[model samples]
Structure formats: structure tokens, C-alpha cells
Target: MNWYRFSDLAIDDDEISMLRRVHIYVCSSKDLEPESAGGTEIGKMLFHLYRQGVRSELGLIRMVTEGEPPPAAEAE
Candidate 1:
């Protein structure tokens, strides 16, 4: 998938799909704690997407990501 700066403001469907896939892959695992590194990154990305006006369900994403840590800067 392609990546862009937040200022670019050109988010596409593939990028959004990738974000949802990441959230699903991370959130669907029973063994994965919501506070884990992987989970934190998912939370961070979903938050970013919501801020960018792309979201399937804000309530559900927030439920898993609200208290989790943001992703590392390198991920940006």
C-alpha cells in the first residue's frame, strides 16, 4: 500500500481498505490484548482515519482504540 503525509489530503479507497484490514486483523484475535503494540497501532491508524473522514463505525473503532497508545512516529 502507498503512504502519504497527513497534509497531503489525498487518501484513497485502497488506503482506507488497508486501514480497515489492519483493524480487523488485529482486533479479531482473541489472544491479542487491546493494549498490545499491534493493537495500539491499529487504534492509532483508526483514529487517524476517523480524523480524515473515513470510518465504517466510529463507536466500534473507539471501543477498541480509545485508550490504546498511538503509533510510533516512524509509522507515519
Candidate 2:
């Protein structure tokens, strides 16, 4: 799969708009909680994704398929 970085999306207005919508959806969703283990995992993924400005689709795939723990200091 081709991964899109922030720099690539920065030049495209349409991609930026799509990313904004994905961000809004994540923030507004009530199902994801920070207290639960799964929720915490998702939270960590979001944190890293935000810092790196990863593509929304790629982030979603990673969140579902990997669930890799992020750096403690960064996640906190």
C-alpha cells in the first residue's frame, strides 16, 4: 500500500479537506474512550498520526490491523 505523508497532502487542497473531515469525525465520535485498553490504543494511534500527519485511510488501517503501542511520553 502507498502511504501518504503530510508533505504530500499539504499541496493538495482536496486531500486537506478530506483529512479535516476525518479528524472531525474522530474527535466527535463517542465510542472511542481513553480509559479502555482498546480506546487507549486508538488514542495512541491518533496521537502519532497527528504528529506525523499520516493519511486518514492509512491511519485507520493501522489502528485496526496493528494496534502497536506508541511511545509512552508521546502518548501521554
Choose the strongest candidate by lDDT.
1
TM-score of each: 0.37, 0.34
Candidate 2 residue lDDT tens string, 1-76: 9887777545367764654554444433534444567556655666567556565665654554465443246554
Instruction: Specify the highest-TM-score model's number.
Output: 1
Give each prediction's root-mean-square deviation over alpha carbons.
12.4, 11.8
* C-alpha RMSD in Å of predicted model 1 compared with the true structure: 12.4
Q: Write the per-residue lDDT of candidate 1 for residues 1-76, one digit (tens) a residue.
A: 9787775766578766756665765576434565778777766867676666664565545555567665446744
- Backbone atom clashes (below 3 Å) for every candidate: 0, 0
Model 1 misplaced regions, further than 4 Å = 1-26, 29-31, 58-76
Which pairs clash in the backbone of model 2?
Answer: none
* Model 1: per-residue Cα lDDT at residue 54: 60
